[model samples]
Target: MIVSSFFPGRIRLRNEVFKDAEIYAALYAAVGNHPAVKKIERNERTGSVLLEYIPEKLPINKLLALQSDLLALGKLAEFYSAKNKPEILKKIKEIESKL
Candidate 1:
């Protein structure tokens, strides 16, 4: 996790999985409703997220871990599976040629 910015009530973080819309949607759905979370914003082009939260309700390090680890592991698992499966590899190569 790369912390691009930090202040008392807000933090902006950068991570590779943050560029994935799927991850963004999941993160927003997972934490958007928490009382500590005041607001959340994302920039897909930069793979970055800006989170505004109440420190009294949620600690910053916990937020950082939750943001960086959960979906990243999912992406890593996806990469590992795709690399191991020959059937998926052929289809991926085929699609890559078309693109």
Candidate 2:
């Protein structure tokens, strides 16, 4: 039951469980014989876990703009303080006018 990966010296663990068709048959037989993990007789098929809410993809341009805005805010915060609110507001207004 050797499973090869692109990266060297890596063998997937599942290969040991389902190595070949013969192993799969043996596993099914063993599980069927065991009372603990007995086969279910369901009419409907079950599905894997899935995501309920999917988010919209953000554009690269918008992402870059957000990053730039964050950097500017960080720079402004470093300069501005509670005691110097008036000066900070004046500077921000001056910058806003330029923009």
Candidate 3:
């Protein structure tokens, strides 16, 4: 994952895995739902994740760590994709699109 931009209360990340809706959805469920996160936006076409958070509640270090973890999971997802069942992968993508 690459940090595309960072401002007072917002940060944008770019990652190839963001194009995979299933992985993106898991990222949302995990980090986007954090109490300190005010909003999260993912653009699959652009492979970008934009996050808005309450700076006072969530420190930059914590957010960075979360992003690092998410990126690591993305790598794992890529590995599993090569070996997982195709039907399961399709189902995950379908469910992710709904969110």
Clashes of each: 0, 0, 0
Candidate 2: residue 44 lDDT (0-100): 18
**Residue-wise C-alpha lDDT for candidate 2, range 1-99, written one tens digit per residue:** 121221221112222223233323433443234333223121112211111111133233433554544345335445544564444344434333322
Residue 21 of model 1, lDDT score: 69
lDDT-better candidate, 1 vs 2: 1
- What are the per-residue Cα lDDT tens digits for candidate 1 across 27-58? 56666777888999999898888989898887
Is candidate 2 or 3 superior in TM-score?
Answer: 3
The better candidate by lDDT, 2 or 3, is: 3
Q: What TM-score do all the candidates reach, one by one?
A: 0.58, 0.24, 0.65
At residue 73, candidate 1 shows an lDDT of 42
Stretches of candidate 1 off by over 4 Å are 60-99
Question: What's the true lDDT of residue 98 in model 3?
Answer: 32
Superior candidate under lDDT, 1 versus 3: 3
Per-residue lDDT of candidate 3, residues 1-99 (tens digit): 577899868989886667877766766775665678899998888889998989887776665655544455445445455454344345444433432
lDDT, candidates in the order shown: 0.63, 0.32, 0.66
Cα deviation of 79 in candidate 1 (Å)?
Answer: 8.0
Cand. 2 Cα-lDDT: 0.32
Native-structure RMSD, model 1: 10.9
